[model samples]
Each structure stands twice: as C-alpha cells, then as structure tokens.
Target: MGSKLSYYMKILLGIIMSILLYGVVVYAQSDALGHEKWEYVLEDSGDILQIAIPVSAGLITLLKEDYKGTKSLALSYGTTLALSYTFKHITKLKRPEGRNRFDSFPSAHTSSAFSGASFLQRRYGWNYGWPAYLLATIVAVSRTEGPDGYHTVWDVLGGAAMGIGSTYLFTKPYENPKLEFGLSVNRSSRILTIRYIL
Candidate 1:
C-alpha cells in the first residue's frame, strides 16, 4: 500500500510539473507580474540555499542504507542545476523591474532547493523530507522578500516545479530498481557468500 501511494504521488508530481512548465512558457511573454522578482532571485549575497541544499542531500544519502539513494540524489540535484542554468541562459529573461527582466526564465535557487528537498523526501520519508522541504520553501519565499532583482513568483514556481518533477521522475524511492552486491569469504576451508540488495 505504501509503495502504491508513493507511486501515485510521483505521478501527481509529474503532472503538476507538466502544467507548470507549460504555464511558464505562456507567461514569459506577458508582463502581468513585472520583472522585479527576477532581480531578487539573482542577488548574489551568499545564498543560504546553496549551503542548505547540499547539506540536506548529504543527510539523506547518509541516513539511507542504500548507496543508490546517494547516487540518485546526486543525479537529481546535478540534472536540476544544469537544466536550471541552461534555462537561465536560453530564456534570457530578466529580473523583476530590472533592465534585463526578459532574461530571467528559471529560478536557480528554487531549482536547487526543490531538487534537493524532493530527493530527500522520496529517499528518506517524512522525517528527513519535511525539513528539507521547509528549507526549500524558504528559498522560494526569499525571492520576493527583498529588493534583489532576481526572480518573480511565477519564475520561482516554474523552477520549483522543474526541480521537484525532475527528481520525482528520476529518484523515486518506491519504484527504484533493486541492485545486488556479492561478496565471498574463504576461511577454514569453508566458502561463504554474502549478498545484499539495495
């Protein structure tokens, strides 16, 4: 039952991502929210998110018995970062109320937080996932908390969707395939085999 529920959640997250991606594309062309949020997102004042995301990822990786959890987290976070940066350049959307507001297509902070938190949540369950997600939410809120011309709410939303969805697709815990390792020990003229699955 638990596994089935998790699978459904993953599917729901994917659908949400698809909707958000489409929405971002359509909204980018309009000036409904202005570009002030973009400026906030780009502000380079030592992003707490940068520090927090990796830490969260590390915790999830460490707490889980399966090394594959670590690998999955790494892949999810890495892909999200790369994609976020690419979108930033490709979209060329500028920050809110900034000269280059049209250049701000994706929110990096949002992407980073979402990716890390999503991985943690799926890998370690609510106990670890809750804090990670809370921090990620803070990162999202920070975009609109100050005068930094980084991103708009819509941009953050789009980024969040991307991060969560990407991780959900790639690192889903319940659906993860099993991996087995074999070890052999020879002692006292006896042969023993040890096998573990992750």
Candidate 2:
C-alpha cells in the first residue's frame, strides 16, 4: 500500500509540475508575443513540450516498471543536454530575437524534445514513437517560427540531430521477459533448447 501510494504521488507530482511549467511558459511570453491566437498556441505548446515530452517518457518507463529504460533515458537525455550546450557555447551563434546574447547554435527545447521522442521510440516501439516524434517536430518548428523565435533553421536542425544521435546511443528496444523450450531434429541429430528472454 505504501509503495502504491508513493507511485500515485509521483505521477500526481509530475502532472502538477507539467501544468505549472505550461502556465509559466504561456504567461512569460504572453506580453511579448503580440501575435495571433494560433501562434500563441503553437508557441505555448512547444514551450510546454520541452518539459512535457521528457516527463511523459520518464513517467511511462516508471508506469511500465522499466527501471532499465529509466536509466537509459537519463543517460540519453543527459548526453543530449551536454552536447547541445557544448555546441551552443562553441558556436556562440546569435539568437533570432537579437537580444545581443550569442549562445543559440542549437535550440535546447528542440534538442530535449527530440531526445525524449527518440528515447520513447527506440526504447518502446512505433506505437509510442510516432506521436512523440510528431510532438518533437512541433517543438522544432516552435523554435524557428513565431514572432519571438529563438533559433534559426540550422539551429533547429542541429538540435534535432543531437537529440536523435544521443538517444540512439543509449536507448534500446524494450522486450518482455519470456521463457521457452524448443526441440529440433536434423535427421540423425536431435537438439533441445531452452531460451529465456529478459
């Protein structure tokens, strides 16, 4: 019962955090956007996704009792962030907003989103991959589109490549545990095999 309660609390906390993050994103940009409703919505979605995609991926692993997958996600995500920031500092490309700050070689939001999406797809299957990929793609566009765009097309592309590349390095396909026995006969020889998949 205690374990179950803790599980529920974790999920609840994740939901709360995601909501707060979304609210902060929308409110933070509301004053500066001055754009159409659709643009605002698009920007809001993308901003929220930076946190949402990874949180959802992490939660899914926990929900499915995939401790190994959780570990893989941590490594993949950490590597993606490290690489993105490393490139940003190395390139020092100017942002689209012309804020005079130059650390926008890669879009963090886009990289994180793609990392999460790739993690889900590679660890699980296409059933989860397609939707995550779709959301990640939106995130990539969000960095490039809108009046207050933060990155150029090259930055978004670089971020996406980093994300996919890092995730592919750490994540593996998830498989269910199975035990089976098989018998084979090859003319004069007979073989029995026991297989356990973990």
Model 2, poorest ten-residue lDDT window?
Answer: 1-10
Q: After superposition, how far is residue 99 of candidate 2 from its true place, in Å?
A: 1.8
lDDT of 1 at 34: 51
> Model 2: what TM-score?
0.76
Tens-place lDDT per residue, model 2, 48-127, is 88888898889888887889999999999999999999999999888888899898889999999999989988987776
Question: Taking the tens digit of each residue's C-alpha lDDT, what string does model 1 give over 75-176?
Answer: 887888888888887887767856645656678888888888788777658745665676677677666554554678888898888899888877865334
Worst 10 residues of 1 by lDDT: 37-46
lDDT of each: 0.65, 0.82
The Cα error of candidate 1 at residue 111, in Å, is 0.5
Q: How many backbone clashes does candidate 1 have?
A: 33
